[model samples]
Target: MSSLDGTVAAPLSPPRPSSRLPRASDQDGSYPRPQMLRGAWADLDGTWSFRNTGDDPAWRTGFPDARDIVVPFPPESPASGIDEPGFHPVVWYARTITRAELDAAGYGGAAPRLLLHFGAVDHRARVWVDGQFIGEHEGGHTPFTLDVTEALGTDPDTAHTLVVRAEDDPHDVTQPRGKQDWHEHPHAIWYRRTTGIWQTVWLEAVPTASIAGLRWTNVDHATMRLTVRLSGERPAGARVRITARWHEGDEDLATVEAVVPVHAHEVEVVVPVARQQNGQAEDELVWSPETPRLVDAVVSLLPAEGPEPLDAVSSYFGVRTVGVDGGAFLLNGRAYDVRSVLNQGYWPESHLAAPSRQALRREVELIKELGFTAARNHQKIEDPRFLYWADRLGLLVWGEAPGAYAFSPLAVQRLVREWMDAVERDASHPSIVTWVPANESWGVQHVATDPAQQAYARSLADVTRALDPTRPVISNDGWEHTNSDIVTVHDYEGDGARLATTYADDAARTALLGGRGPADRRILVGGAVDEGQPVMLTEFGGVDFQPGAKREDGWGYTSAVDDDDWVARITALYDGVRASAFLAGSCWTQLTDTVQETNGLLNADRTPKVPIERIRAAVTGR
Candidate 1:
């Protein structure tokens, strides 16, 4: 067959065996969706037939070239085997799913329906199974699924060809691109682009009537709320059963079942914690960076009269709450000094895609070892697997959305849709303590003056709260805030005494409250006034220091002469931040040194530029 672009379609070749197979056990931390786990699933992270289609739409039906690329890694990354730095707006991927693979994933077992899940695909993606169009999705940073059972036909022995088409315009500034650069070359804060398939792709088998989604809400210290959404057939008199247990023990802490009405597709039930029933202190069961306790849960769908569940999935959550009280950032109703580091979530080898699942777990451990309780995932909707590690390992996270450079109606629509999806996808994770929708006025550039931009900024915060009100929403993270739950400022001043004087006492409060602050931008906009929101120095202390490298080779807010100088500079910065009596929390500029940004506490390869102990002490001031 010949493609419409005057090119003969190449014969589909067998998928090359991937050296990086999915981890065998969920306990080993290879499961892509950590919060929700099903026994019957197959990892699709492997080799695939790849082709750069450029701007040609003709390649959607068939590709004319034969190439190989690794799944879940963008082509711009060295790990993908096609480390092309230049822009290729359109790309295609193809792989064959054999009957053996399907059978191993339980396709003909208890669960018959087959669901193909993509953890994330950049910009836009369209899926086809055996030449039949299955579905399409937009927004690069969130997951989407397609039921391909019918597309694969009823034959259990049949093999199916799965194809994906991704379109990511590098010059399209209206999209929520985050730190992905629009130019051909990386510069300043922006790095290389992640065009397509930067996260996991997997397959799962489920019954016709199955659990589609699960959400856990910490209703109170003593109560937890579970919301279940069903898929396919919603039989009348169906029931959803929920059983929650402590992570360590086999004893069921709470069990609750709710009946689904004839037409109801969703149901919510409250599960009471037994440990906190008798006026016991909520500390034992509550989740925090110190304790890091988790409650594992199994959600099942049952017919009105059946002894067997139609479908089941395992999940986990923590009983915790985050809020701002006066000048304190409260966690579980108690004041907590948030020590956070800005994590860009990029790797030298894999770009936005993590090098491996184990790397994600180590990232969390490294953050904790550095003495920071929280990580602000700056300008990226991180992989859910990373959030799983954070949930298990007890590191707080601030969920943020990628920002668009240009502001337009399309930009507003794209950003809102993606940001909402990001929140809804991660809302169940216990690690996420805050939602940052905009940073430094990236999309809403005129928010400080323009009424429309201000409304947009306010709406982002408002809509995020509407979805998940448990976490505080920073409307604009850095500056030019409107309707923000926390008043956050971004200042890179290096001098310790000067930084202290700038943020001290009533003078700083007056300046910040009156729409003036360190960044020389308005702290409040759209006539919004500070309503006693907890003020935090959210961004500061970007001291560039790369051992055995020239200072001019990399960039940061400030430069350090050597390792000792780096320690002294960071310690002074922390001291200055601590000097501010009204500050509720602080987040340093970065966790790792990115490609050209060498101001990280650790090097890009997860190596500490200075001793880990010194970095911890500087970060914690202890």
Candidate 2:
């Protein structure tokens, strides 16, 4: 198939090796990774000796004599390499992927869409297939794909060697590294940095003429509409048939079918009430964070000549809505307040990668148990595991980016691109309600005023609109916030009333074009705090370490170095902060202690740092 961008699909110009089958060196204690992956399916994880450059550096030639670290996990992380010092910043990764699957899939299709899907490669990495120069990809946060359809040797049944070279310096502030500190090990709000293939790699097979993508309009039950987009060569009357199977549990439910003529890149297929369209019963389940019901769908293409499954992809969708009338936010046409905690998805064992699905679900379960409906993932693009559970477990979410504290046009471009991929890849979930670009102006200058930053933020807004416009996007989360659907504000120790002072200033100073969303955690500051504004107090209440105990410092208004006093003081302030109407909602500092900053509601081992009862009182106001 031709490239989606109109460029000729590049083939294996370089010769590939008829090499031996590739397999990971070590698999002991490695994550039970998923069987299947999207894009060019490849798994570049397993076991490799990890050593920082500061150690004896003699492993470049033959295998170094050292402890084994798991692949895909950064050397800085305990999960990767030996639990000792993390891998040297510049490290080499070795792994192999089965090419037989690619050869088998290409049996009947035009050709196998063998792509190397890297969830994320920190700093930068170069890729090789069977020692063939596949390509190189930069950017550590987003996912990227490479078409290596022709790179595999002629043999249809052999594993091809896949090599990746990763390098990252902790001090490089120009990248979109959320909270990694270079000089010292992660301390005081800073966590360890993960470099190289933090995400998954896989190969996916598709027909020459395949449905590139599809859009579900997630309306109400009776009026579910979907748009089908076919890529590649299409005849004038090329017929595309879509079969949608909606299910609740084991019980087989309803199935809807539609056929449309394929245009260049799109074809709008309206699915009206079954009765309204063809006098058939139209019954479909709705999805929300609460119920989080999912309806499954499989799109099949049948040519006008007869019946043939040109392309088929099994997908799921959720039906939900968000809006606001007066002051309250609404979900499913009802009032919903955004109560969230800053959730940074990090684990003691797997910095970003969750050991198992349960690890991911536990985070969501703990958040709900804390008596909150939502969580704002602090500053990083989270793994899909979190979303998978958020959709099933009923937790509203405010998705944030791995912050770009250092500003750059190139960095901004990569940020927006990766974010777009994240948005489109995860848009079908029901829990995600908000989108963000800039968080606290870490990498921005006069973001609210600077033309470039403004344009970048606006461009992100535009991209979000083009991709999924239903949700809202904050151009810049905090500083110089403008051009957003919601009035998102960020404040630290300010009281509710003092927090509301900004809105008062906005109301008093600038003309109100129209009311936007209650700005982030600071939706409405209120009376109280002669000392400060009646802050919504969105971010408060994180004392991971015991008070009076010396641990790593964290980045927040109040750091709880020790759990005893700091925890009590931090939790108490949150309790006091929530007592004002000036604040519409509040999300605590964070869900878990990411790396060294241990002031999470939960501990590094998924343990509750603070007793659940202590935190629930503040959330439920008991």
- lDDT per residue, candidate 2, 1-622, as tens digits? 1211112222212111101111111111122221111122223456644444442223332234445667667766667644543435776665546545454334324434554567677877776666676788766776676766677756766776656667776667777788766655665566666776676665555566666666666554346556767766665567655444444455545555556666666777665434323323321355565566665544555554655455555455565766444444557656565778888877777676666556677888888888778888877777666776676677888777776666686677767766776676666567787777667666665564467765666667678867877776655554344455454445464343543443343242132222223232222112101222112334555544543345544444555544465545654565554444444456777777666665566766767765777767755666
- Please give, for residues 1-622, the per-residue lDDT of candidate 1 as tens digits: 2211112233222112111222111246788787777776788888998988454555545566758999889999899999998997888998888887797677876678899999999989999988888999999999999998888777778788888999999999999999999989889889999989999888988888888888888777677788888888787777776544463454444333333332478788677665565545567678899988887666667777753567767777888888888778899889999999999999989999999998999999999999999999999999888888888889999999999988898999999999988988999998999999999999888888898888888888999999998889999998888888899999999998889987888677877679577768988888888788899899999999979948565989999988889999999999999999788889998999998899999999999997899999887888
Which consecutive 10 residues in model 1 have the weakest lDDT in total?
14-23
**Model 2, 596: alpha-carbon shift in Å?**
3.3
- TM-scores of the candidates are 0.93, 0.77
State residue 549's C-alpha deviation in candidate 1, in Å.
2.7
Model 2 worst lDDT run, 10 consecutive residues? 17-26
The reply for model 2, stretches above 4 Å from the true place, is 1-44, 48-69, 82-89, 99-111, 167-169, 219-237, 273-284, 448-459, 494-537, 543-579, 582-584
Q: How many backbone clashes does candidate 1 have?
A: 0
